[model samples]
Target: MAKYTLTVNGGNKEVEAMEDMPLLWVIRDLLGMKGTKFGCGQALCGACTVHLDGVAIRSCSLPVSSVGEGKITTIEGLSEGCDHPVQKAWVQHNVPQCGYCQSGQIMNAAALLTANPTPTDEEIEQGMAGNLCRCGTYNRIKEAIVTASKSL
Candidate 1:
């Protein structure tokens, strides 16, 4: 095992783990941060989405050693008391169904808004395309993203 010092949510976290271990496991299992979920370990699903230096990435497929010095931001770090604009928009639009994929969805939306505060509809669609909500809440997700953009 090797020691890795990760910058997560503006804090430094030290963990001892194998190099091949995925960041998802490190965040959830080791660090006890459970907001980032594991859907598909192959990186196909967006359920493990987290911000790596402010860019959204699939933590499930990202090895802990590969993270280097990138700042990781999970859903829990998005805001205090889940009061982020995207989160607020989600509540306003009632975007959760089953609530399994909402964390990743909200994280992705927050990153998109951070990069492009006023994204167009096509941009929002493309940005959120990777995240799948089995409950078919895509319309609500899109509306929430748009609402968040306006609020941000």
Candidate 2:
């Protein structure tokens, strides 16, 4: 086991784990930050999405050691009291079914808007492409993203 000090949600967090352990386990298991979910252990599913230096990344496949000095932002850190524009838009649009993947969805949307404050509908879809919502709330997700863009 090795020691890693990760900057998560604006704070420094020290943890111990195997070098090959995924960041998802570090965030969820070791750090006890549960908002970032584990869907497919592979990186294919964005259910474990988190911001690494403000870029959306699949934590499930990212080794803890590779994170180095990057800042990690999980859904819990997305905002205070769920006031993030994207989160507000999500609730305004009622964009969840099973709600299993909304955290990842929200995190992905936040990253998208951060990079492109005003994204067209097509761009929203393109940006949210890899993050899968099994409930197929794609339309509502897109609408929420559009609505969130206006608030950004």
Q: Highest lDDT among the candidates is held by which one? A: 2
Model 1 CA deviation exceeding 4 Å by range = none
Q: What is the lDDT for 29 in model 2?
A: 94
Q: Which segments of candidate 2 are over 4 A away from where they belong?
A: none
Best by TM-score: 2
Candidate 2 lDDT, 1-152, residue by residue in tens: 99999999999998999999999999999999888999999988799999999999999999999999999999999999999999999999999989999999999999999999998888998999999989999999999999988887
Per-residue lDDT of model 1, residues 1-152, tens digit only: 99999999889999999999999999999999999999988887799999999999999999999999899999989899989999999999999979988889999999999999999989999989999999999999999999988887
What are the RMSD figures for all models against the true structure?
Answer: 0.7, 0.6
Global lDDT of each model? 0.93, 0.94
